[model samples]
Target: MKKIFAILMTVSITYFASSQSKTFPIASTLTTIDGETINSNTFKHDGPIIIDFWATYCKPCIIKYNTLKDKYAEWQKRTGVKIISISIDPASRVESAKKFVEAFEWPYEMYFDLDSELISKLNNGSKVVPLTLIYDKDFNLVHKSTGASVLYEGSAKKGVKHLYSGKKEITDFTVDLSKYFEIIDQIISK
Candidate 1:
């Protein structure tokens, strides 16, 4: 009994220490919007990188992309961070997805995960749209959120409020990009 207890304690400590130092898997291969294959490691730089998982048909995802498109340049300049937007749309919708991306004129790197390879690697099995993952300069997974609203203050609750409002529902939603920038600031400062 004493020997068994000692072995269990050793395993527990090893597991805890490993879990505490989790890093992002930057070796996964993902395709660019231009159909060029590339590895996620290409995004790693001297600063943090934000990977946004989205779908073409997802309304909230569209809102988040639009908001990010407007502020991407400023955010890049200020924080030296890069945002990689990955589309998890079906293969049949690849053309449509390209059209949508072109319409928005997003100045960030865009990729299509038709087989969900990268998404599966990042999300760990659960598939959800508008998922954002932030990785530090060393490729460590720093922050992750399921929805765009979570990136900003009160945006999620505000969307819920509009849904329950006794008036024509507002379809337009926006997030405070400054909040996201603040996150980059915090991660890079560390």
Candidate 2:
């Protein structure tokens, strides 16, 4: 009986700790494009936030950014969702990362993880580009996905053409962002 009670108590404690770990990491430090230092709390109150991790060298990251560039404005207007793009580049590439952002003129809030400290805290030091995390109004993590947006791609004969199934090359792909958008919509509606 004593052993069973002890095991149950241990399980309860572990469950509580894991559940509580979903909150945004207040200790995380990130640098703005202009070199201003900021922490996770800086945006905690502004929930329904999307934190997108990227690097200067990640092609999928650039593709993802370009794919969402135009929709960002509409998303903000519709859901009041705030997107924060953070560069996970090493310290040496910080300048290049800034230049890349400038050249693209990305409109969302931008920052850099010089030492990847924020990335480590939020992503368990995974350091993978194109990692996206969505936090709720209360700053609890609601969703997380790694890699670029899901792309629907297929191949077929040259003569195959249709309204919803047309193709120019052997393989055509389209970014699927509805999943993220739906999650954001749900988060705000809650």
Give lDDT tens digits, candidate 2, residues 7-34: 9999999998665524455677888888
Candidate 1 residue runs with Cα over 4 Å from true position = 1-24, 150-157, 160-171
At residue 100, give the lDDT of candidate 2: 74
lDDT, candidate 1, at 175: 60
Candidate 2, RMSD to the unseen true structure: 10.2
lDDT of each: 0.75, 0.75
Q: Indicate the TM-score of model 1.
A: 0.74
Regions of model 2 farther than 4 Å from truth: 1-24, 150-174
TM-score for model 2? 0.72
- Model 2, CA-based lDDT: 0.75
TM-scores for every predicted model:
0.74, 0.72
lDDT computed for candidate 1? 0.75
Candidate 1 on 79-166: residue-level lDDT in tens? 8888888999987998999998888787777888878877787788877988888888777788888865522233444563553352
